[model samples]
Target: MRTPPTIPAHLPRLAARFDLSSEDLGNCAERCAARVQRLADLWSHAGTPPGQVMRTLRRTAKRHSVYMPQKDSAAECINRMSDPAWWRRALRKRFRAVELHAIQTGAVHRHASPYVSAKALRRHELNAARLAAQMDGLEAINQTTGEAVPMSDLIEASLANPANRRAALMARIKGIETSALAKSHVGLFLTITCPSRMHPRHSMSGAPNAAYDGTYPGRAHAYLSRVWSTATRRAAHLGLTAYGLRVVEPHHDACPHWHLLVFTPADQADAYADNLRAYALADSPNELGAQERRFTVKRIDPAKGSAVGYVAKYVSKSIDGEGVDFDSESDNDGRAAARRQIAWARTWGIRQFQFFGVPPITPTRELYRVSAAGLPGLALPELHQACKANDYAAWLATVEAHELRLGVDYAERESTRYRGETTKAISGLTVEGGDLTQPLSLVTRCDTWRIEPRAKGQAQAPSERAATGSDFSPWTRFNNSAPIDAKGLFPSDAPRAKTEKKGEEGETAVRGSVLHRAPLPGAGRGDWESARPAA
Candidate 1:
């Protein structure tokens, strides 16, 4: 029997090592499937000619001013996405190093987590009865190793141990807690569930009556916004706007509920909850008792872990996220309708987490660099501004706009990179810069610095450079790569070379073979080299 899977945050560093016994080897298929899916997503433009994307980029590169890098270099940048370094940079642009660091260290032991198995599910009487009748058909015995593995053991490891994902999420949650603690005296962890479906798929089985629709999330968001507004009006000093976290929840019907965390002054806590209830009642329109449990809240205990943890706890455990294949209908049906919900959510690009009115987290890239060298934050204010805007270009602007308080140990350029730096300075920055996960600006998704200090005769202003949207796109690089299959099947999608008829004389086949043709008298002689086929 495999040991139960555990989450990262809940475990200490010692317990995080990869253990194969705890892993299941069944993910091989899923890995292959995921690779195919990635290839398909990356090569979606397989049908589009490369010239179309490249033409514009080339034009932009040739016409771009001094501010713009060379056209070939720009094209090469997109081409470099195939490199590991470029992939790392891409991920770095999207996430803070500290958050990634925690995830890396926590999930250091990457192995197939034995999160699902056949024997376990078969423990139930009905399932066991069904299995006993079909035991001979399983062919569970290993052909070579002769191990009697259960058939369930071979099921693709589609579902991961929720703990593996919680590692990164919890790290960010701790950051959120730090900000909440500093900015607001009071914090509430809360949940808001969507109403029972109006026309549920399984009205008798308690499936939603009214399924999640395109307008549902918008309506829910409007209701939540109104409730928060009502709460604010009810209490002047409540400071409900101090900090807020609304994590979009995915359900079986592909709808959303939300887990939210908000901060206020301690004295206004009661007033906040009461005003919320009142708004919930008032919005009932023609509704009766309880108003559908409108909302629920709990106090945060700073002494424990973090207030942010309570709300983010469900985020990584949910089925709808980065790893899911929203387009793949073959996704496991056993995961409680997660595939359908994921597909539904994917169609809309539903955000996993959203923040409103919270103090913006600062960019610590410089801090990370400086700290890596054991230096202090010399440009704190500028860092804060860039962080507040969550813009990479703005961050570069901040890098140039400020002067640093240098010490004897400081160097001209700090060695900050996406990975492998450990210094107390970085640790301090991680503590101070909480939850930098939100997509705060356009630059947040980009790795390259779009803004540079202006030259006397600069080619383009920073704002203009930002708008140019790079004419030489990265997608054209796919032209250099092997084409992906339209159907995304492994082995099956691979390109097959055309072959000539076997009977026709061709370079592919040996003409005077020992099996059919008369053996040549000097076939093995070095002197007969001139008679070799052109191949």
Candidate 2:
């Protein structure tokens, strides 16, 4: 004498959309009643209209893999549709922080988002402080020599620090300057921005744009990347060769823009500028402000300042905001803007800086890690010496001798870890023609290291002196650190070390590894740590 289950009126529509029977939809709705009610509550709380909510639900249903022909069976679709994660991901995709907050708290809070939202900024700071606290007493142990170094010290030696990264970028720029001077090249500064449709919010007023195409920050960044790639390819087609750095920064509303500092032959500068401009404006050519505001170029006059000096503030502002005062674009102070920039970048997985048309810098960085004792008899002895000496100008000369140029001459061979092996690792270097047997093959990384937590009340290890023939050491005060892993364990391209036993749901298990330092944006890409300046 039990009553039959009641189905929603929209079951017919959903069944038709998913190509399933109404009976199946009715059963799913009944079994997943709590999830359905929760979603309805969320939509109601957020004041989403019925038509819009239906559209969102339909889109979510269409996103399942089973909807694709011959991809997955309808049974699999039903199983996934019953999953809580399916509903959760859809909601997350449809709503961002503001709407999610409204749904959860039942109260609307005004978010005066400038470059990044206030809540996001606070969360980023808290997480950063927490990570710093966790790494306070940890130490890195080099498996090769049983050498113990403070974790903090290793970080300073590596490119993880903003100060260190800034120094490295400047040195490379100066190196490029030397080459440009030697080749009689001129520096050109360029700025490129996305079209109006990609920006969801207006920069100045912070109002939502009615004409926005619903593009998120990550996709907007992808569009910019595509535009740059097309422009660079066209420049190559026209025989315009330029080499330098590009920095990506966020506008007030969090849309990304590019700032390029490139050096090209004097004869090709104007042509290069024209090529970039033409490609940048090719999309939305007639949109408002597209003509005058889209792309801009300026000549870098050495009399006024070096090319590095011209972009020094930009590098500083993006990384640590060390000497900058205020940003006119975001109307935020240096430190604040920097925090927003970091948060924006981390949130969207965007690479903030990149160099082009340069030889790989991995070999040089690996040379730095080579102990003075290992220096002798290393392959490419002069290249090793120049890198160890921190002589970029000399390093470029050595690299050119091998006929290596990024894209044109060589491909990178990354370091790897064999299966089931945690301690043994190989470092990455460049290979000519993507062939290891080629004469241009150079194996730069020679050391293997393991990281473990320092025992309580352990004394810090003494610093290692700079390499022989080098004027200074970046690691003299601290010692070399292993590359960062996600779990703060030693460097690995694979999953981090785990606890003795995997934790069951809602249970705490003591993890053997600590959290490694965070990586630069774009986790999958190689060559983040080092790339050589153009010769």
Best by TM-score: 2
Model 1 weakest 10-residue run by lDDT = 514-523
For candidate 1, the lDDT comes to 0.35
Candidate 1, residues 1-535, lDDT tens digits: the string is 3321322343333222211111121232234334434543454456434555455434432331101222343234234332343333232222212222222222211121011112212222333344333431332222222333222211111012222223323433444555546545677876665444311122123222333222333355455566666666765565443456667654322335567777777877777766666665564434432354546778887877566457533453344232333322113322433333333333333565666653232233222112112112444445544433323334434444453221111112221321222222111122222232321111111011111122334333223534764222111101111112212222331232212123422212112211111111111111101122234
Clashes of 1: 13
Model 2 error, position 93 (Å): 11
TM-score of every model versus the real structure = 0.36, 0.63
lDDT of residue 411 for candidate 1: 14
| Residue 403 in candidate 1, Cα distance off native in Å | 16
For residue 324, model 2's alpha carbon misses the true position, in angstroms, by: 0.4
Cα shift from native, residue 99, model 2 (Å): 9.6
